[model samples]
Target: MDLELKGKVAIVTGASQGIGKAAALRLAAEGARVVIAARGRELLDRVAQEIRAAGGSVAAVPADVSRAEDCARLVAEAVKAFGRLDILVNNAGTSATGAFESVTDELWQADFELKLFAAIRLARLALPHMNRQGGGRIVNITNIGAKQPRAKSMPTTVTRAAGLAFTKALSKEFAPQQILVNSICIGSVRAGQHEAKAAKAGVALEQYYANLAKDIPLGRVGRAEEVANAIAFLASGAASFITGSSINLDGGASAVL
Candidate 1:
């Protein structure tokens, strides 16, 4: 049960809410010094407070990972606060799904910047620090759509597919140095976006979730904490040998896996 995370330092992006928030809390619970990042300053601060209330060491850095400078700044801020970086969770992204024709050039550019480029830049920045420490973990938060692409799921699926490839390539290049890389392929987890969509449709939240579960074999949508459990495990010392792999956290919803 010991994740062996005490005294480690981790940076989690898109960490203001949902899966990101859950991952931050889980890492802090395991006694890791956590740096939480998101575009929303208020929500980011709240998460930091919750971690502190739980007696966890944490720093909140509000950054839009889609921007190159922000990604660099996030890394610098974390190292400045903690003196070293041991884990990097590239979780800052939104699910932008739609018909190919309906997807604008602007949307494509934005998706690549947020989901793909950000991860690239952060890993590039975090690698040297990990090298100094001798080893580290980079847990990319991708999703099942990366492997099981469906109709009308253009940019999101495409972006995530790149993430899977990135995870493998990075892991292979860094394994000799003991810098393990992996990804958590998420499923239909209950998130802030789903809550907003349910409210907009005037459907009760539970009913909305019930409708979503109709197609899932597990008969329920996944919780953020469920995904966080895997994130924490992958980032911990216990997962020392795991690299260049993607764990599907879909509860039997993903057919390809």
Candidate 2:
């Protein structure tokens, strides 16, 4: 059960809440020094403080991943705090729901910049550091919509597809250097967004979740921690040979390859 991650350093984006927060905590639990980056300074600081209270080494760096300078800053800040970077989790993206005709140019640009371009900038910045360390791991938190596109998701579908492509191509490029790059395509998970939507609908949380679960084959949406576990495994030495692959973490919601 030893992830062999002690003394390792990791950078997790969108780490203020949900999956990113869960991943950050999980990595720290496994004995890795963690740097949590996100747009919300307060939330990021809270997560860092919580981890520290749990006897984990952590630092909070608030940065909007959409900006290239911010992405570079995120990497720089993590390295400054941890001395080295061993893992990069690109998890700072939002789900966009809109039809092709309804999607605005601004929305498309925003999605691409936030999800695809952000990953590109961070990965580019982290490459040299990982190469210097002789090896590292990169995990991109894409969505199942990337593979199972729907009419309602225009920009998210397209941009996540690009992220998947980035994951695969970069994985191949970094494998020779012993760095493993992979993507995790998440499906419906119990997140703050869902909770907010449920509250707005004036429905009991359990009823709301049950209604949402009707569409999933597992009869329920996944927990953020569930996805974090998979990410931890992939980032750890346990998945040393895994790269250039997209692992779907949907509860049979996505039937595509």
Candidate 3:
């Protein structure tokens, strides 16, 4: 099916690896001119080169989204490179899981800065461009823990809850302008953190993933590409009517409806 994404311009944060990198590749494959952002210069450039090698139009911008100035610069560079921005995928974040008492003020502040505030700042910066262009899409990559928090999940859950609220609020405020805003609440997707855990456990990578699947109803962890597919759809014309909604990309692991 045609996503109607050809010639569209997209900016995907955390694009150096994992779900962000996967989403960037998918958008470019669907014919969007993609601007990939991450703090790691070499890895970000490598992703861009891979996209270009596949005959996709892409550029890599190294930026730490946790900084407000970096967020502004990233958006500016994308606009300068593409002339217009059609999609903003706010996928830059790290998991900050801990017990409530273990999560100090510093951890909470840092988590909010990177996950919640970064999305807020980027959306604020990009909304005018979308408004001027008549419409756009914003996809926030959150986690199911936002809706179904566990006992020990502290800073991450709190911040992701804020992200969920942000997505809904933006969707309502911008829908009249045809600017759709949505979020994908991911579960146990294969990412760098999971890979590192597997290595540290001295377990085979595949076995570690299999162990993770034991708790999931689907009996498997999600792939980065699978999450990317969801993000691409949300950013495409096919999802024109979808807004203010948070879809769980988990493998039925989340108990909440």
lDDT of 3 by residue, 36-85 (tens): 99999999999999999999999789999999999999999999999999
Flag clash pairs in model 1: none
- Against the reference, the lDDT scores of all candidates come to 0.95, 0.92, 0.95
**Candidate 1 local accuracy as lDDT?**
0.95
lDDT of 1 by residue, 28-53 (tens): 99999999999999999999999999
Q: What's the lDDT for candidate 2?
A: 0.92
What lDDT is reached at residue 206 by model 2? 85
Instruction: Count clashes in each candidate, considering only residues at least 3 apart in sequence or on different chains.
Output: 0, 0, 0
Q: Model 3, residue 140: displacement in angstroms?
A: 0.4
Which has the better TM-score: candidate 2, or candidate 3? 3
- The CA-based lDDT of model 3 is what? 0.95
Consecutive 10-residue window with the lowest summed lDDT within model 3: 94-103
